[model samples]
Target chain A: MSAQGETPVSRRLSKIKHIVIICSGKGGVGKSSVSVQVALSLYASSPNARVGILDVDLTGPSIPRMLGLDGHPVHQSTDGWVPVYADGGEARLACMSVAFLLKRKDDSVIWRGPKKNAMIRQFLSDVRWGELDYLIIDTPPGTSDEHISLIEHLSPVHSRLSGIVVTTPQAVALLDAMKCVSFTRTVSLPLLGVIENMSGYACPCCGEISNVFSTGGGESMAKRGSIPFLGTLPIDTELVTLLDAAAETEQEDDKPIEDVEHEGFRLLRRYKATSSAKLFGPIVENILSRLSGFTAQ
Target chain B: MIAIQQPLDVPANAPDHCPGTESDLAGKVDACEGCPNQDTCASGQAKSAAQDPTMIPMINERLAGVKRKILVLSGKGGVGKSTFTSQLGWALAADEDVQTGIMDIDICGPSIPTILGISNESIHSSSSGWSPIYVQPNLSAISIGFLLPSQASAVIWRGPKKNGIISQFLRDVDWGDLDWMLVDTPPGTSDEHLSVVRYLKDTVGVDGAVLITTPQEVALQDVRKEIDFCRKVGIPILGLVENMSGFVCPGCKTESQIFKPSTGGAKRLAEEVGIELLGTVPLDPRIGKSADYGVSFLDEYPDSPASQAYLDIIDRLRGILGDK
Candidate 1:
């Protein structure tokens, strides 16, 4: 464990092997969900691999809610602020977010540029992530202060800093997603690939895959931008319901329930079987293969 | 300050290309062939000289024409700040006596132009200043969207540049004698929000802010901070607007909670903050289509449940503004 106060970020994050930032130029394209799923999928694929999910979407932190860690406070030790750990069955995933620091789950963070930068810096330097194989950072929409600050802060510490841009298969979303790709290029960050989320919706009753927004936009974007096309995630309402149920159940932790009996727990199990979860398998594999290739270089 | 050079008069038989009318100034044709000041204009140095100084007095002078200023803000993205602003503008303009103008300060994602059906309208610069494009008889707007050469062109600007443009939007745009001026801000409480609140406060004094949020706990959580921001900055919050509260199924008209309020919803949030919950607008598919097609849902579907909710919200806003 690294000592917390006044320690340099590079030394603090030196143990982390790889850092992947999930970002989108446009909001509401399921960036946070993709980040969470990727982190979980990485953990699922390699049970021994240490995964840490950092929700740096300071103003709008949704990773905590999605992972059922909302209202959990970060603990401070002699090492640093300890992140909350979520049990992913055989493997455990550590989580840290600004949402944990707020008094209420509904409290807003009305911070300016300097404040946001400072918060991101503190999250990078202060969190006691320990030695981890992967650190997935979820950022807010656009290439704003958070994006620049995170990249600038991590470039000195982590050489294997890569980015995964997320976008829906819609022209309007792709228009912004292209900017995200361009932003990664301008920053000189290595692009792992692009994930087209909410590409289609599988009707539970009809058993038909309906094109919700549109499909193949992200694949074409990846080809045009010369980045790897990761995969497409379908819009799964069950996943949303599972996330909401988890958040509610976790907030009501006073009443302990058996893991097998918890509704949220059951819903999460069902969520892991959904098409979106299956989509994450290929995306995670692509990201790992790309990272290995980079390491070889 | 640079001295203003008087332009030479056009000859009696010269072509009808004099830069006198609004159309001539707005059009692409250059009519400065024989003018004495053409040299300075050709080099674009005079344009800088004519730029409005970003001072409090200058902004106040420009805002003096507007009777009331309302800022629409949302802490969470995709919560429909631009959609609500456009609808509010249309609803306010529905009254023939009321004049409204929307100033979109969302530099990166300025959806005002597209939402208000004025995406093709060009902003014309005159000797006075830049004029906002009038989308309707009673409604006009100014946005960073209009400044872009194409819709696909992104405004990849940093904080200071965005602040500069927002200040310029308020100080330079010719929004004359508006009964109401609605300032639509980007999601989050960052540079844009601070700039709009600070500028409005120092210049014309903002009436209040209408905070928008969805019913989900994820959105309500951030919106709470927005309210705290208004209080901390000494700006009164008019009320809270719960958008996309429920989804009315078109088949049976049964309202369902699409994005359920895991944290007790906005009504509870407003109670905790001791503010008014203006109204809750159900999720309507047409609303999305309207925004995409640059049409006002309120005008196109006046009988929509969402439109009625907006009308009620507007009524509450009017009550807060003491307009009714």
Candidate 2:
């Protein structure tokens, strides 16, 4: 590998190609879930591509719980703060958050802006993150200090960092997302697109899709602002169940959640596959290409 | 020489100069309780007392230098809050009659310096205060963008903290007497907008605020919400400007509304909110192109339809402010 600490554009910069921040303008849009899926999507396309997910939300860090990574202590060694590997033997995929280092996972991090920026900077510089194809930063709701600091600090290095803003199809969410788009554009960052999460919900008994957050808010906002519109995600209770079950399963067990033997796990995979193929695949490819400074055909 | 020799015997006895204790110093400070500079000295000492305690007085002192606070908000974002702010600032500066500055509170997505054609190297600070780069001869501007590391970084802020940051921007910046201060707020009636309005209402009164919107149903709906917010806060509505209302075809000079033409977005909303219609910006390619190229359309194409429309808006705003 090229010696570490090279400039972001240098050929020796390694596996890390771009940093994509997955955020929401308002809360309860499944921002973390979308972030996880985006990280996994990048990995699925290029399995060996190094990837890191930094949960800067501070308040609602769902990576540990969602990935079924629980009770894993973050390893601190001479190489810097090392993210706990889920599979242990397999290559590490993402970084563990400061949330995991706390005695209690649910405690609030009441840090001021400068210190928050300092912590986020530590997450970037102190972490022994190797060259990776992508670093996904999942941020909480609203435009405020932490988000500004993350974007400001990272922008100088990652010139091509694109944003995947998630919003529900509601007036409030769209309004906030619209501000988000303007905010992103103001700084001259390429708006990758808007993702409409919880676009619809399907009742298993009725076998019919129902508008959950009122569909088309994202598309309308995108159309109005002229931003690229990413595909929508339906609310699936089974996916939630599978995620919960995955967290409970032992990492090394033969019946691990990824094994697909679990019915809920199988259902989750099928849903992800269908959604990834139908909606997220193209969006991911487009963003990755854009950040890599390549035009899509 | 003879006069100096007379005091030599007493010169050997030096005055006692023992360092005072903390309590003794506190007593001395208490003794100056009613003095005008007492608070300044006390707070200055307190700031150095801790590794990084809240330096309340220093921060308050920084706030005293601000002048001419303006709030640039829209019922919606795509309607051109950022665009209007940049253009209005440019227009003010273009005219030798006024000096202008802008503070972008759109923390989620700051674009002030960018629209003003400023770069990372352009944003600088000095002993005087954080210096805003002059976009026009008399216009200086700052945004959360200037403080950012890059456009791609995520701005993840919450409500209360967002308020604190806005306050800091207002009170901390060394904005010397400005003819006008334009604040570009994030869309919606959220904490960002509320923070700016509240700060102006509670601490400093705003002269007036302009609302930007397009002729569209979705934008109109949010406009009503924003209007209600302003009313609740008692912030005076300066006027409403319709942006991107009708697109004029470059080939034929034929105007067409891309989202169905209706006066409802700005005009009707202005009437409903009991405010005057400032003006309408035609759907001009030059505006978009100028924003893309980081130059105000007025500067690039002085006679363009968009530029003319912006000039008209400025005229109306001047009338409202009695800038005869």
Badly placed stretches (over 4 Å) of model 2 are: A1-297, B1-68, B261-263
Cα lDDT for residue B225, candidate 1: 75
DockQ of each model against the real complex?
A: 0.19, 0.07
TM-score of each: 0.82, 0.49
Going through the candidates in the order shown, the clash numbers are: 2, 18
- Chain B alone, candidate 1, TM-score of 0.84
Model 1, DockQ value? 0.19
Give the range where candidate 2 chain A is weakest over 10 consecutive residues by summed lDDT: A1-10
Q: How far off is model 1, as Cα RMSD?
A: 8.6
Q: Pick the candidate with the highest TM-score.
A: 1
Q: Give lDDT tens digits, candidate 1, residues A57-113.
A: 888788887888777888899999988886534224789999899997656587777
